[model samples]
Target: MWVTSSTATALLPTAIALGNFDGIHRGHQEVVRSIVGVDATGSEDCSIRRTVVTFNPHPREFFSGQRRQLLTPQEEKVRLLEALGIEQLVLLPFDRELATLSPQDFVEKILVRQLQAKRIGVGKDFHFGYQRQGTAEDLRAIAQNHDIEVKIVSLQACGRDRVSSSLIRQSLQEGDIPQANRLLGRPYQLAGTVVTGQQLGRTIGFPTANLQLPDNKFLPRYGVYSVRVVLEKTALLGVMNIGCRPTVNAEAKPTVEVHLLDWSGDLYEQTLTVNLEEFLRPEQKFSSLDALKAQIQTDCKRAKDLLNSQL
Candidate 1:
């Protein structure tokens, strides 16, 4: 149900949740739910398709001509949206022409004429069209001309702070895993392909799975973490390290490697998703491989204790 086109004619009348839903966090979920509802029936009268309209190449990325590290990349976002019962996702290409569309034109031409949007939902702070001049209120006033309903959902907050993608990113960057997970309404996850590594862990009787992530996947703080590894629907406990193997080679780039506790198998080329549960310690360089091995043993023990306590 991922329709990656700017011009594909929608077959059914649509109720849309519109935004660059980067994280699909609580606040984004609110906007989506406002339109799709809990059952995802869309609207009462018509058989409306539940659609989410998001820009491709994200406006920031388009403008900067650079890929931004993402909380939820396209594939993950599509999967998450489908789980929320969305029927279709329209990825509009963000380019110079789309950027120059006036607010009225954006609503009338894009939402009304093209998508046949009967209802649209957006966050209160949502902006669109012509140098980002369109506000939520503007959308409401303009959509009214086309007899379209616009729901501007209020900002969602967690305690004193607002629930936002940037706030969650900051929490992750600081290695505040609990805070980030709390805001996200789930654990912060990184999914990657299991690749071959230097086999240093194997030599020490602890084989690890090295993850190959997307070039623009956003990483949390580079540290040792208590984590849960999901493979083929089975969850396993593990100790994950997200940093350069400084003791082995200080000049190496940061890498994500995990040693699953009480689990052993060939995981080469298979996909695994790691959910960071707790940050145990910062990455530190040790004098020798033996010293690093000893620290890893402690890390695995602590990770096991933390994961078991949760269960």
Candidate 2:
């Protein structure tokens, strides 16, 4: 999907799906699918684009004056949306001026005038305008005045619990990888560039790739995990440690280190995406290097067996 900033010229008349879409979880997927399905029915009108409208800097981050932890950062979100068949993405800069717009003005000016949206899709709980004063019903009422159609999708659930970004974040923070994956309809992933580390792993027979993640990326519980590493077109089973390495340097900062099973290469500066498949264990400080090495060997075996079992 192609992306554009808010200031970009108005797009062709579009059917827009709107939300923060932080995780692009099952619920978000339903919203996007609803709009895409609508667009498909009007296939003859090539001028009507399938668009997704979201905010940059996430409104919560802007208000907090801090970088909020993100479930899926901008690049990942774009990839997920593109996979859902969205043709356009519009990122509106959430500044003070935009925040102050009233409900009527927001719909008339931003959606109708700027985005040229002919139809709008949002979740049932969606809110917009200054101080989040507008509800989904208000959106429908306002958009109707401008001759625009609106679709408000109900909440999606897995078992009894609703599928939402906040719930998914809680599951990750709690190291409930299975629950998180179920809600997301896929394994929760972390993508970043591999950077140089202390070279401590190789000294003990397990070489690892140290991942440097984005500041705003939400980190799961600090623990050992069984993961799948994506390197270009290859997927390798791996054991990942997310911790401060208390066995080596107790004062060290938290870091992500992945030891890919049956893989070896110079991976410095290469980007890699790791999908968390299972939570192995919490970080622990070993009494000695040999003890830590032994435990890692066990961890590697466990990871291999678990990953291979899925096949």
Q: Highest lDDT: which candidate?
A: 2
Q: Per-residue lDDT for 28-94 in model 2, tens only?
A: 9988987785553454456788889999879998899987889998888889999998888889999
lDDT against the true structure, each candidate: 0.89, 0.90
Task: Give the number of colliding residue pairs in candidate 1.
Answer: 0
Please identify model 2 stretches exceeding 4 Å from their true place.
40-44
Show the lowest summed lDDT stretch of 10 residues, model 2. Answer: 37-46
What does candidate 1's lDDT look like per residue over 199-303, in tens digits?
888998889999999777889999999999999999999999999887876545789999999999999999999999999999899988888889999999999
Q: What TM-score against the true fold does each predicted structure earn?
A: 0.95, 0.95
Candidate 2 yields a Cα-based lDDT of 0.90
lDDT of 2 at 183: 100
